[model samples]
Target: GDDVRVAAFGPNYANEKFTPRCTAVSMGSSNNVQRELCRAKVLLVPTKAEGGPLVAAYAWALGVPVMMHNTGIAASCQECYARLTGDAAADAATALSIVRGADTDPRWQRP
Candidate 1:
């Protein structure tokens, strides 16, 4: 969708194909990564190839809703907002709504 912007935080390899809408940002230190992750409304994990439990775990710890295709790691993320609706647009909307409602959730005390 026109509203969705994807930023890939890593080096761009010659063999990789990145769309125009997706910006390739350089990978940073742990603190920088944490700060960047905290700013996102949703953390889309996409596939097992992208990462494993550690990434999902971090997103959950920070209260960011994670959207990923089925994987053992994805299943392990316990946030109520982490369900994949299977429709990309719908999932994105749900993710944004989850972030908007985060302040109201008693379970999520801001870090």
Candidate 2:
């Protein structure tokens, strides 16, 4: 959580300049960006409204765990996703625990 940070990849977000402290976002090639996601330890999707993004599936295919709250995804997505609530620190802690684990396999197993 503290060590690794989140970045967005989409549209003109690649050119948009955000505050230095803000996470890096690339709105460029989806394929390239997705390929890069493979090395990442966590993928956070904290959107307010989403119609189950395909990226979730892609993450699963690559074996990269996910940390989500608010965003929705297709039924087949097996990425480790959590419903964030209560406190922000709690969510961060949850993500930290997952990231710290050595196993690359996702924790979220939907029934």
Candidate 3:
């Protein structure tokens, strides 16, 4: 199997037990949130709720693809990404499958 590491930064991660493959860190201050997010190869947004287009737009602007639930907002972004069903488990599974072969979408390409 390919090596995979999971790291989460947030209060939700505190006191959570994870497999050896996963790690959690504090979310820290808001100032550095973007910087921290950029470190990731892909941004995972697992919420069923929609936070408007900017949420996914910002990630794409940072050159990070987002795997998020299909809440209309993500699809509206007009970017290529794996759109997830509302089911948490299913979404996560689909995201993993997509990311394995994911690449920067051509829409994000610059001349």
Candidate 4:
């Protein structure tokens, strides 16, 4: 949406297509990573396959909500999960809904 700001971290060749809409950042130093994570309202891990992303742990520790693919620790944890339907629009809508819920849901509130 127009109200949402997306910042993507890591190497993505198609980052140019999402320019202005998505700000791409490099996964450099730990300090840099922490800074970026701290600025985020929700950490979205949309990967189809992942061994185990420790960034989710860091986000949780920092009191940030996570909306990840239904894999790895996300399957076991009580965090939000993004469904992959092979339809880009549908998947995006689902992701948006999850993000909106995270923003308003009291369960995601920090102490």
Candidate 5:
């Protein structure tokens, strides 16, 4: 992640701030989160709600493990977690742990 690598701030249409990496993008859309989820080995959702979220479904279908620590997740979420934390450092550590843990997991194995 290099602290920051070719990042486009979340979809902010009110200000229209989407600066590409000096490259010509086709749609000019800043849906980096989705793209990252698709390419990442695991999906880290910080939200507090995602039982059967379409995003989670997408990850499940794409064979990408999803890690989260919040309430309201459905009982079917074996890939989800509920770690407690309020520090950014802890969040990063937890997220990293989830990412690393998922690397060796066979739960995401495709059919």
Candidate 6:
């Protein structure tokens, strides 16, 4: 857990508190977004309501694994998506497991 770094991009409408390891990333240019994505080991999109996240596409293109809420394009995709029950604790646990898996799973590894 200490080895993992979490970065939050975009607005935090919920005003959720983050751990010290989590950094709040300001929304910036597309290049800045891409630079962040490039450094990520996995991209986790936990939003329950979304049509299709453009960032997920960018992550895919960069060969980064994605663990997203089961909605929109993530619903159609066969791998790397989870059904969120709207329970914050449960959802966070699920997200953690997904991230851990992505770190070790060969399927999530770039070629």
Candidates in order have lDDT scores of 0.63, 0.62, 0.62, 0.68, 0.54, 0.71
What lDDT score is found at residue 79 in candidate 3?
56
* Per-model TM-score on C-alpha atoms: 0.62, 0.64, 0.63, 0.68, 0.52, 0.68
Q: How close to the true structure is residue 61 of candidate 1, measured as C-alpha lDDT?
A: 84
- Model 5 lDDT vs. the true structure? 0.54
Positional deviation of 71 in candidate 5, in angstroms?
4.3
- What are the clashing pairs of model 3? none
Please write out the lDDT profile of model 6 over residues 17-39, one tens digit for every residue. 66444665665555487778888
Lowest lDDT sum, 10 consecutive residues, model 2, at 102-111
> What TM-score quantifies how close candidate 4 is to the native fold?
0.68
Q: Which candidate achieves the best lDDT against the true structure?
A: 6
| Model 5, C-alpha of 84: deviation from truth (Å) | 6.6
Ten-residue region with minimum lDDT total, candidate 3? 102-111
lDDT of 4 by residue, 1-111 (tens): 337767776666455688856655556555577778788777777776886788987777776777677777777875443445667778667666766676677645544
Model 6: lDDT of residue 51: 92
Clashing pairs in 1: none
Q: Measured by TM-score, how close is model 2 to the native structure?
A: 0.64
lDDT (Cα, tens digit) per residue for candidate 5, span 22-79: 3333435565545665666655555565455556666667677665655445345654
In the order shown, the candidates' Cα RMSDs to the true structure are 4.1, 4.9, 3.6, 3.2, 5.5, 3.3
Return the clash pairs for model 2, or none. 9-26, 10-26, 10-27, 11-27, 52-73
In model 5, how large is the Cα lDDT of residue 28? 53
**What are the per-residue Cα lDDT tens digits for candidate 2 across 1-107?**
16676666555445536556566555555557665776677776666567776776677667666666555663344334655554778988877877777374336
